[model samples]
Target chain A: MSRLSKKERQKLLKQVIKDNPFLTDKELADKFEVSIQTIRLDRLELGIPEVRERTKTVAQNAYARLRSVNEGEVIGELTKLKLDNYAESYLTTTREMALQKTPIIRGHHIFAQANSLAVAVIDAEKVVTGSAEIKFTRPVMVGDVIKARAEVKEIKGKKYFVEIKIYKDSDLVFYGDFTMFKLENGGV
Target chain B: MSRLSKKERQKLLKQVIKDNPFLTDKELADKFEVSIQTIRLDRLELGIPEVRERTKTVAQNAYARLRSVNEGEVIGELTKLKLDNYAESYLTTTREMALQKTPIIRGHHIFAQANSLAVAVIDAEKVVTGSAEIKFTRPVMVGDVIKARAEVKEIKGKKYFVEIKIYKDSDLVFYGDFTMFKLENGGV
Candidate 1:
């Protein structure tokens, strides 16, 4: 490892990070058998952001591409979205969402989260749901943290087909396929 | 008009009421140039129910064919439902449904009503929303009386495609296209 030149180590560092984006600077330093300062310098020279910044960039890019729904209108905290591509969100069910006499969250609450994500993924001036098919494999309960992922499957004219899956921990809880229609920005 | 026989008048009355179910007994009596009592007697002889009963029957038939959702679980007052055909529901937004600092009802409430109507129209032991495309054409305010209608547009195997429209005072306020999945009665 000591025989490796600075240029060679920087190249390897870049590849390792691309493979595993969560690694810390200290970990990279240890793997490269170099001092932490050297790793930091290499990262700065290569214009590579820190892990936190890297993660934030993905999320920011997603939000920036959103056009249909406002940030507050999104049912859950949208974690990431790429226009006409893929998106992610996180929702923690509240006590008020519980069904009568049960801890299970109301079905509509789940649908709202998934539906909003589908609309947000469309890169358009406005979007409409043309239709959807959905299923719930398990009940989500109050206080359960759910994660949702959406992917655009196809686009035909002004229509977009999106698929969304929601999970609680590792369990698949809900699924939805949305057909969205993109509308012109203004009537004029 | 007096020269017309009773049978001839009753036959015309039947056809007229069929064309316009909302006409009252008084209106019919005036139109037929007969007393209200005579129209009532004629309706009884013809096995035609009162207008209120006629409307109630349509609503009752709709609610009766519902198997996928319990009446209480429905988001709005399910007025009429015919399994695998068409259905109607009415929802009046309450004060609690109003958004913060605005009298407008939240978008999710409108979606809940449409989604529940979609699920309730499926004549299955159990039903799941496979996906939907939806739009809020106008903001629904608190105390707004909204009417929703759903029709089964198509079906393929275990899937049902439904179209739903909502109106507030004859203005189209919302729309949804839903794809629903029917699950078997028992996991056993």
Candidate 2:
């Protein structure tokens, strides 16, 4: 990072953020030993969007694929989906999610977010959950936002093992491991 | 029901609804071989609320337990909860849960409601999900109301296996088998 030429640095920057789109410009600058402005210029010159825009594009692309292929479901506000790889979504507990007249959100809702994110990450037109193991570490309340990220840990024939974790800000509130069945091509 | 006296019929009605709180008045009327009005009268005489109200009380009781016991979560509006036995909740898809700018509800929100109900049904000072296997059968639209019911199928030491299902009216939309961990008394 320190000794690369301008073109090489820009290429590496692209790869780094492409791999992990949540990195801030300031963080990139620190890693690259450059000013934030320099990082921004590199992003612009390379025709790359900011971290937020990058995620929006990934999520939007996944939606487009779902639309084109015909069937799939994604719950929560999908923020990013790289099918067959990983996906993430955001959900904020609303009053409707709380126990009637109470502010604490139901635990299943947290699992739902994680489980659905796991489902969304599958690279198939149709996927169904086969089973799950999950844990809730903390409680979520109405108006609190959670980001659920799911990654495909392994795929065996038609069976996909997905791992999901949810955070309220940086606080981990939920976790899930899902076994999903891809029902494409007669389940292969 | 025809052979029983009025008091006996009423007693059975109360117990039936207590065991399964979602039975509609019409269903009860059919089961009792009595008119809807007669079922209503029996409900009122027995001091048992209407099906909707009955669920509300059960759900509210669970919420109260959560508050006093200091942990546990319910994501969807809990409709009913019988700790160490069963619980159910309701959720409606909102625009926030859809893919960005799309009307399709994300898959995870469906799981969230069911998973939360599973968490709310445990009789414990603290509980966490251990794992789950889930399947999505149909797409959920914005404004669609889903009923998620979780039943404690078995318990082994501190681990509980809960089965959850989500229905849109009578249409089964999702299913999950969950492994949950109840963390009380050092996990017993």
Candidate 3:
């Protein structure tokens, strides 16, 4: 690939970091075919924090928005929630959540992010999984950022039917149809 | 509940610890309506390690049995795995897996455990979840030990049907039926 102009590279760098905040400066340099100093200067010029700082800020913002579910319960950081309606979460696959043999993120972590978002979107005291139909369309690797969205499709009495879809950079990686059971007021 | 004889209490203590290695001596004392010292003595007499030691042993044993899948990908420690046949795993709910408002374990943790075990049981270079039907029969609290079992019920071409069940003690807590698709050899 031809070398990108400084302006074009800076713009692309911002987009890349937004898409995957876990990419280190070295990786960015390799990907952009630029020096590490160039990437750092570009990041500073764009007012983008370092990768670790970016991740922490994103996680804190997501944690602050948690409403129906506990901060700890959600597999990923929750980015949005509208009770009994819609929810969105963000998960960055880490080394700890990847396979040792390969750096690929495990399927279950994706499922957990989807399933938990489905539960978190419910307006109830307690929610449990009744059933789920899930599909993984692609493999996700470590350092990938997954954005999962859950929409409550229907509610029949105490049962909620939710549709969850996960994406990595505009590509669908996973989706699930989840049926959740909501407990009555204050019941276990 | 009535008070038990000394021998009965000791036996029960050992069994309880086996089921939930996270329970502290004080918690056991509270449950048994005895002093902490008494519980410690009982543990000593039964040759049972302390809670932390018990947890470490279980985790180590589970980690030792892992194959084909990354150790970090599985939510619980894998105790047994027979590729394309059967698998078993153990999880001890920690404070991080519990709800802030309530100490009950998050539903997704249970789902992750079952889902990962289902993926691990497949005999393939790569396995992806195609769909799943899951039910949470009961709430699991913090400090609880969850044991999950997955059995491959059927295999057809590239698709494998798996049944996963999770239990807290003898009580069934969750169950799922998963359909997984195996990728062709060396396919991404």
Question: What does DockQ come to for candidate 1?
Answer: 0.15
Per-residue CA lDDT of model 1 for B1-188, tens digit only, reads 56468989999999977744545799789878999999999999999999888756655666676777655677877777778888788787898765344566766678888878887887776666666667677767888878889999998878889999998857899888887777664211
The candidate 3 chain B region of ten consecutive residues with least summed lDDT is: B62-71
Off by over 4 Å in 2: A1-11, A22-35, A67-73, A76-114, A117-127, A133-188, B1-11, B30-35, B67-73, B76-114, B121-127, B130-188
- First chain TM-score in every candidate? 0.67, 0.64, 0.72
Instruction: List per-prediction Cα lDDT, in the order shown.
Output: 0.77, 0.72, 0.80
Can you write out model 1's per-residue Cα lDDT over A1-188, one digit (the tens) per residue? 56578889989989877644545788778778888899889999999999778656655665676677665677877778778898888787998775344566767899889878987888876666666667777878788778899999998878789999998867999887777777664211
Top candidate when judged by lDDT against the true structure: 3
Give the per-residue lDDT of model 3 (tens digit) for A59-146.
Answer: 6776665555767778777766667788877887898877676666777778778878987888876777777777888889898878
Model 1 RMSD in Å is: 11.3
- Considering only chain B, report the TM-score of each candidate against the true chain B: 0.68, 0.65, 0.73
Cα displacement (Å) at residue B88, model 2 = 7.0
**Order of models, best TM-score first:** 3, 2, 1
Report the Cα lDDT for residue A143, model 2. 84
| DockQ agreement of candidate 2 with the native complex | 0.30
